[model samples]
Target: MALEQLSEVIQRCQALPENSYTSEDYDLFTVAGRTCIEEGNSLQLLSIVLDEKNQEIVQCMGWNLLPPLVQVLLKKENKDLPHCLAVFNHLIEVCRPKELLIGLLEQLEHDDPDTTAESLHVLLTPLQKLLNLGVRKASSLGMALSSVLEQLCKLPVPETTEQEQDDVFSLGQCCSELSAFIQPFVEEAQHNHIRGKDSAQMMGDLPHNEDELRTELLKCMQVLSRLLLGVQLRDMDTLPESPLRDFASSILIGDSLPALVHRPLLRHRHIPGFLEEEVRYPKESLACIAHLLFVHHLLADMFPTVYQELYEKTLVRVEDCGLPVDLLEIKSFLSVPQNLVKVMTICPHQNLRSKGLKVFQLSIDKFNTEAKYKFFLMLKTSNHSGVEGYIIKNIKNQIDSALKAEGGNVWFEGLHLLPLLRSVLMLPDGPETDLLQYMDIMESLNLLRYLVIRDKTGIWTELYKIEDTFLKPLRVGINMSRAHYERELLITKEDKKTKAKVSVGDEKLPNMTTDTHIKALHSALHTFDMIESVLVRIEELVD
Candidate 1:
């Protein structure tokens, strides 16, 4: 019934004049995609269309019909395994449901590694869309990726036969294609405006739903990140026989680092006809690549050596390019190290700290106004919630050590670290408390004290001297606390008296004197007094 409805919709759409069908066709296609899944029988029809034996039927279904049908099959629950698998195999051959194919590729990465690798190759034709989807789905997809990667890492190097080399080469081709596809999407995700609801919402307001486009793009990036990391690790062992050895070697040798770092301006000189067509580049590619590199550096053992070479190469390029190199590219390159610092702090390695510190130093130097602000914001947000404990702890330690070693002076002088500090103070209640304890107890106290002293005597003294200025707000807060405590005390005493009066005939009334209530009142008053005292001390210094 569902397939019949879909067929009716397709026929109706096909009957419309070509010029008139543009908008109507899209609506029909969307409905068909949705309905095919709603009615379980859609898969049976899709199977017929996708079957190799029914080439005419497959060709007649056309590209438009393929994507939605694939979507239906993919989304179907309690689906017949044989039918679904057959449909999937056909979809791979036709590359009709490009989006669904990308989704499956990502899903496959988490399945058995050998199976996933084969699946990845089969789905490689629509490499660009696949890469975009990988990036969009990276966060959710990261969990299952390591297993497939582990298998790829275990593949035998210097294969005994030509076929073995060819298989490895095929995998490399998939990786390269996948990498190119996702690179842009990752870049966009990074530059995604923090002020907006999200990249998807922003994209939605445009012609098509930007959210879906971005989501698909991110999924692609994630898949690419996993695939590239796996391929790089695998090829590292097969350097002699690997087709990707040169590309891998180039990355290792730092030859590609400059191009990658300055990728915004560099055209793909190697790709034929790239120069002739005016292809509008996607914004997220570089950002995505940087993230991929950062992740590889963080998770894979091979990245440190690769990153070191890349880092040195980047520094050289910056030096030669001078101060006015493309700010966006520079920001992207600088972010790699900071991300590594955050990643290493949680994961930990004795060797990583120095590398993290080096990157930190470089970030401090190269990070401009916008970059600095964004970094602090990320620290603040990461510190708040959705951040791991070890990472938070490591970051706190790094910040503290930097501050104690006068690293604070550098951070303060160059970029404001106060926002990052503010985030630390406001950390969400969780296991991350260990990280907070390190800073909240002593560091925050010291920082607050330092600010108080600086306001009194330093360049900020005049700001403190003004009436109803720096110290006034603290006084107001103290007064509010005192008033709130008084109100609570009154309520407690009234409750105690009411309870004493309501005692039963046989039950003697306990001492319901508001003593405990009074004690709490005293404690609250004491805290208010302490706050007042701190403010008074500041007022005196201003005088």
Candidate 2:
């Protein structure tokens, strides 16, 4: 175990040819390996063995030294730690990259968290080096990267398991490694010249170029899509706090994600048509990106700068190519009405919200009666006044459509129509609710008025249920709100008069203005009065 033993192993290794080593030589080399840490000259020994002239030593005993080098690395106080790391780096060049990578991956599962973390942390350099190896020393790594992503997709979210701290640390490290692993290939693929036909090379060797890089990128994204598409970020704002929830929130609040996300849309002044093809590469990428932005609010920002940039960029491309995808439709996540509703409800941008509304209006009719019915129910739960109002209006439209001679009345007629009608007829938080805050109540009233006037025959059988379940409560609520607001209005007027008399000054202070307050109260009173009249008309029509 002395330095001389390592020296003897080195001398014996230098005298042998590649693949010509006997069992005796390997035995001697294994016997001398302990000196790497025991001699206190680990760095010097590592330096000597890493020399170009000692390829024989490295080829013969490089993997053999990995165990002891990691042992040295685990020693917090080891002075030769940095030297050991340098040797590990050199070992990557001499040993097969896959073998070195597999060794690191194995260490990541160690029962001791510190060991798992160090193993994960150390993976960064070797991964980068292995990726940088390109096709020179290895074939396409698309499959390997895919396998790694599959494993990452299975890592238990932090705080959900007994290993809370370990889970968080490991997940954080994995996210870092995931970012580092994909960035180079993503950045490289940004160039149009390197962009090739989109195909997923899931298995087998391919030439290292746009084809291979993109295959690797696609496989990784496919894994991510499987993991992410199954998640519902639509109600992330309401989700109970958890490590995964917190992580998703952090991503939403943070600045834009790196090239893996925005770069595809941001890089090109004008993207090709294939970017939106039905095929995999960009489609999977786009699907994941859209899911992140729409459902998870991953890219949503208060200022809309990121949304603005991406929207403008993609808009230009869409207009240029006449691509079927529209940013307005949120075409990526638009397949699900809930996702679109989530984006429209929570998006901060006024223009995007308006555009989303337009898209929702145009697309709502495209769904069958059943889907539209379900979507109406979904919108009611949004708790958003505009969304509620919009859905209520749609409910009225569907009933009107069913009444038309040519309209099939498939699911929007008779009993099928009652469920849709009931979804919009009820007051949110009951009639005593803040009517102004729940403007959708007026839309509900209008819908009721339309139904009573247009199709009372269809719903006559259910009128009692409607009145008892929806109208009676609404009537009580409206009356209560009316009296409450009238009292507030009377008090507000009296207060204003007193303030006017007390103010001896000619000019009024900004805070002294009660006109806006009075107008708000009058508006509330007017709304309640209008709702009462609708109730009266319905009662009269039924009588």
Candidate 3:
């Protein structure tokens, strides 16, 4: 069904002429790319573009409207994969530097060869291509590029006035600067991959990987296309590669424009990464399952899928995971625990996968004598892993649940898992870590709230320590984030002398904006204040 629907859309996109598809259809294409998998065509269009590109249906289609489709498709890493390959294929088909040079040769041998001026314009075609390619694969291609520029610089230095000599040298100097400018990109590519919370993870960019290098070649194509915006490839090829080649032999021959040879090269900008992946949140975590008794089993019968895995399959515990603070409360459903607390957990009512990763940390050693007998049963019932930290966490949760249960005769929802709270707060974290799940903090603070209420005298000291140790570091992180964004906030200044301009959008930087960073900083600070306020209330109640 999905395949047929997608085929129909492709037929429509291809069957109709370019003018036939309206701007409304363009908007639908964007929506279809984002929602087809969820609502309409079930990703039928993406499959046609990927697996069936050679078919007659799309082969005749002129890809004029491809840019907008590409913009929406590149929002995530996985979604952008097919487009990445397509762009790579396009670049491979169009860029022929060797061919460009050969055409330059034809011009040098023409009957009325005006070698200098016309040949230099033709030379720009391949020079720009090489520059863009060097930007993409600078680490390995840098030396070869520097070598090419050196060859171009070998032209005879006319012993005329200094100004003429300066013109010739300027072109060589720009090429040399461009050659050395790719160092920053090479360094960034080598830094660790960002395993973001979003599903659209970045495609791996290993500089040494030949396959990755091939796809990345597309980055240069955009810049090259911009420079050659309206020029015809056939027309450029009619010119010659020679006058440049002949001039490079350290000899100044007759019948060539030395003036054109000395013309400054066109300055091209570096290709911006429009397809970089979105970052994920809450990097580290542990998963543990909740056990069910008779009443729980009965509830499970009502919504078998939801209750069966109520706390079974999808259980994740990280420092923080909630959305921005101003949204007020976590958009989750309330579920009761045993008698010690009323609301034990708040699980996702829909899209349980957003709860992040589903992991198995159950182990025989962690499951005490009470749960020890159920070891074989657990192995059969749940997906299990021997990951030591997760296993240790699982065992601690089991013990915490059992301890909470011993104090009451109610069925356990594993809500009063004290050890889980301690492990989360007392757990060692990186100095600048901010990717915490809000639920974790809420749960930990909730447990403290319950503790202080039940055993006020005994719990205050522990609560203070937890606040100092856990919440303090979080406060520090929030402040640092605020300070950082404050610097990022763009400040517009006016000058009386010349009226200087400072754009809010700095072309050199990406994801650096006053509003976005400020909002995030404000969000972090808000979450911190809420946590601190709760801690203060709990402390006062204990006192």
lDDT of candidates 1 onward, in order: 0.45, 0.61, 0.36
**What digit string (tens of lDDT, one per residue) describes model 1 on residues 469-519?**
324544554566577778988888887777777767878577535776678
lDDT of 2 by residue, 98-171 (tens): 55655655543455544544555555557667657645322335544644554556654443233433445466
Candidate 3 Cα deviation (angstroms), residue 182: 53
Question: In model 1, where is the ten-residue run with the lowest total lDDT?
Answer: 272-281
Candidate 3 wrong stretches, greater than 4 Å: 1-421, 430-432, 435-439, 456-468, 471-515
Which order, best to worst by lDDT?
2, 1, 3
lDDT of 3 by residue, 1-543 (tens): 434444456656765664466665545544444444433342344445455432432332313223333333333345544554353234323434343223323332323222232333333343444445443443233333333333333333322233233434333333333333333333333332122212223444433212233223223222112211211111113333322122221111110122212322212223344223211111110010012211123122322244433433222222222222222222331111111011112222222222212322211332234333233222222222222233334433444454566744121123333333454454245337543343345445555565556552234445666767766665565567556544543231112112223345653333334445556656765676776677677757756
> Which residue segments of model 1 deviate by more than 4 Å?
1-54, 62-68, 75-77, 91-255, 262-264, 267-481, 488-526, 532-543
Point to the candidate with the largest TM-score.
2
**Per-residue lDDT of 111 in model 3:** 33
